[model samples]
Target: MILIVVGVIMIVTSLVSTVTTNYKKLQLQPTTESPGRDDWHHFSTGSYKLFPTEVNYEAAKNGCRNANARLVTEGIRNKVTRKSIMDEMILPAFNANKLGEGYGVWIGLDDLEVINKWKWIDGIASTNDNTAWAPSEPNNGSERCGMLHKLLKWLINDEYCLVANAYVCEIAKSK
Candidate 1:
């Protein structure tokens, strides 16, 4: 009888664990589709445009300027906006470049002007708490440009400024 009880308890524990794991998984999963559209993708919670084309940091800045936007940065200050950009723009761009295209995309964060002091192209100062960086990243002293790492859940990393990569553009909501 004791052995039977132990077996029953084990079954119960296994069932509970499975249920908990599934629940957690559902909570973590994000919607595969993006939120809104403005000829360019837009997240209703945040106003910004995503340009998935490949370009170096300087060219990207110029492109955004031409389009009346800036490279994505200000709108990504919070988790919701950041996740939207990742799922809607960054992920798709990364997937499309699977054929030996590029490593990552620019996101306006860089420490080129000063060591360890990352700032967005728009002059917004970046703080460690405000952004996500891949493990042991920003390690290369010479590669002072910042990018959204495709394999690392869109985490930020520093890379060579000269290397061309896809970039995201941010258009502020017109008041």
Candidate 2:
């Protein structure tokens, strides 16, 4: 009986140590399913990070690339996803007055290559039926880059690519 009790305690101790070590490894590994960084927020679609500093559209794209992510483009497919991004990542910064003078964030949609032919960075064409655009938006042909207009209730609007704005980065889930 004494030998059995000793063996049981040893086995329990080994299991506890293994579990603790595995937990530490999991915590160290960067995961898209959870927010590993303070600025990142994980949603069902992916992990998003808001960069509150103002920068030109190109700069914003580069920043995201530097972080092993991309400017939020394909992740925002419809109203539901857009709303989730706004409520989860963008709104908190806007509510806190953390955004730049533009009061918006740069997304990956742009008509830089072809006028009025909006496409995401991944080369996916934006559908006209998408209702995320603000009223009378994408009006200025010269303003080809896309951004979420905070004053317009987080609706999308075209802006000049040269204009500086806060931007959101996303680590998309693997299909």
Q: TM-score: which candidate is best?
A: 2
Summarize candidate 2's per-residue lDDT along 18-53 as a digit string, tens digits: 999999999999767534566677777777888999
Model 1 TM-score, 2 decimals? 0.69
Candidate 1: tens digits of C-alpha lDDT, residues 125-163: 887787678888878888888887767666788888888
- Native RMSD of candidate 2 (Å): 7.0
Poorly placed runs, candidate 1 (over 4 Å): 1-37, 44-46, 96-100
Per-candidate RMSD, Å: 17.3, 7.0
lDDT, residue 118, model 2: 90
Among these predicted structures, which one has the highest lDDT? 2
Report lDDT per candidate. Answer: 0.75, 0.83
Candidate 1, residue 97: Cα displacement in angstroms equals 4.7
